[model samples]
Target: MARDSLIRHYAYLVRVVVGRLVPGGKSRLEVDDLVGSGIAGLIRAVDTYDPAREVKFETYATANIRGAVLEAIRNEDFLPRSIRDRLRAFDRASLATEVRIGRPATDHELANELGVTEEHVGRLRIAAVASRVGSLDDSTSGSEGDTLRFGDMVADPSVDLDRELQDNEVREALTNALGHLPERERTVVGLYYTENLTFLEIGRVLGISESRAYQLHGQALSRLRQRFRPMLMAA
Candidate 1:
């Protein structure tokens, strides 16, 4: 098929992907804003498309469309390095915890595992949201565990709404802990816990050496544990 025909067919799907990734956008940036990312992927796919490649266009095209979206998002000044670090840490811990438990890990369980307060765990979720960049063609997470495994947040059938509210209150407590952290501590702690960026990535963003990044993240976690442990212990 010609390039224009291919473009006409796939444009709508690409737009929807962008809309989902960036929930609150004003829509001034037309769906075509994501086209560049899609086009790049499509061009690559097309060049690589083998006559012997038994795969259909939809599979190939969807990837192209997602890639476009991710590319566009990366252009934005996205999440800070601290948040990224926390996200990585959360992902790593979740994977390991699941393996150990032989079941999915709860958000609360994860917070405890990382030695951070439950409030910071909520902040980690808020930061886990992806950017509007077209799909990167590569996944950041290797664990194919269910995305909805954070069952602590899911509504329970037997519990009344009031009880659910209480559960949310605990989640809110975790968020509050994150809010109370100093800006540097907040950033470093997230890097160390949620995003799980290696010290190298954290240092690159922080303008410090790899070892320095590790030092900062370690110290940040130590201080947070010290400050919050008393309150949690008392409570």
Candidate 2:
């Protein structure tokens, strides 16, 4: 079947599926948002739908709609500053300690290198672990798996050489700027981008609440942004 026609035919099913999944909540997501997402999913599904398959369209379209909505959320991107700072700190400390000692930094070594205690190092390690262990309310309007994919969820959109070059430039600038940041600042930056840890994870790493982690991270980022405005703007 032609993709457009197939989608138009089943688009109503998409809305029905999304409505069933994400009933209204305190969230700001609109039915139209889910409808749009479902339609996109249906189009994709049409390209791949099998005529012989006994499975219902609802089951298949549900996945597509959820995927689309999830993709949008991923694009909207929820992250906390404390998370970013802890990450930056961890990245710098690890690399610096690794090069200085010619090996991966042990918890003891990482702590000593950063002028913190072994317990503190362990906190950072806990923070660095990748998991969907969020206590945050992640329930959505659909039945899609809500597992966190951190860096994997980050979409890459380099459409051309110029864009790619700009991305690389931005990455390089961030690296240099991160290298120059204080440990707290560095950790937050690294946690969010490199370690792919959550704000709560960062708080665990730094022996603070997730909220505190956010505050520190914001402060660190604000400082970095103020200091590196020219370079960042150029990027």
Candidate 3:
């Protein structure tokens, strides 16, 4: 395909990937900026793609596009260091509280643990979710010291056949995990990921405050992360 034609035809892929990465307008970067970077990746993919490879062009191009968007975000360093530190402190306090109580910690409990108001905890929760967007590009060490990206593990429709079976297994495990979540947590996860709704929108739909929705999101992610630990370690 001519380069311009290829870009025009596949441009929607950029928006799709961007929506997944920055759902709910959570990121500091504008959607247009991210899309611009993704287009660069698509152009690069067109120039370098080898049709003889087993992978589909869409699969290959998606990876490039995602990488470009992430790189742009990293270069910008959108999250302030103070916020990152607070997020780490919040995670620690949350885990400690959960261990002591034998259940997920509530926002009030976390606030008391951290010596902050519940309102601050709410901001921290929002920051935590925002931080996760950049975390997609983070590298994970496998049992054998090989490196993998969190983004690569997320199931993509265009994944090559070699990864199809593994992706299926992951999806099955996720389905089972989702089944195990409490009704509200499950609903939050569904609306956030499946429906691509923001926490604010989810709050309106579920008739809860936005902070409450964020709390549920954090709790659900903690549960899902625990379930995925073994898979990540063995990867």
Give the best candidate by lDDT: 3
List the candidate numbers ranked by TM-score, top first: 3, 2, 1
Give the count of colliding residue pairs in each prediction.
Answer: 32, 20, 0
Q: Using Cα atoms with residue i matched to residue i, what is each candidate's TM-score against the true structure?
A: 0.33, 0.35, 0.46
Cα-based lDDT for every prediction = 0.48, 0.49, 0.59
lDDT of 1 by residue, 3-105 (tens): 6676676666665545444323223454456655666666665565544544456555554454444445544434444543554466556544544554446
Candidates 1 and 2 compared: the better one by TM-score is 2
The residue-by-residue lDDT of candidate 3 on 1-235, one tens digit each, is 7888998999999987776654332334566888899899889878877776545677667767865665555455544555445555665576446445544466688789999987676555544433443344322211222222223334322222233224344446557767988999999878766665666788899999877887887677667655544443232
- Superposition error at 142 for model 2 (Å): 21
Local accuracy of candidate 2 as per-residue lDDT tens digits, 1-235? 5667767777777755554344233155555765677678677767765545554555555455545554443333233445535534654576445434444456677777778887665444433321111111233111122223322222121011133224443346445655887888678757754675666777888888877666765565455545443431221
Clashing pairs in 3: none
Residue-level error in angstroms, candidate 2, position 133: 25
Error of 1 at 63 (Å): 1.2
What is candidate 1's local distance difference test score?
A: 0.48
Off by over 4 Å in 3: 1-13, 30-37, 49-63, 66-154, 157-168, 194-207
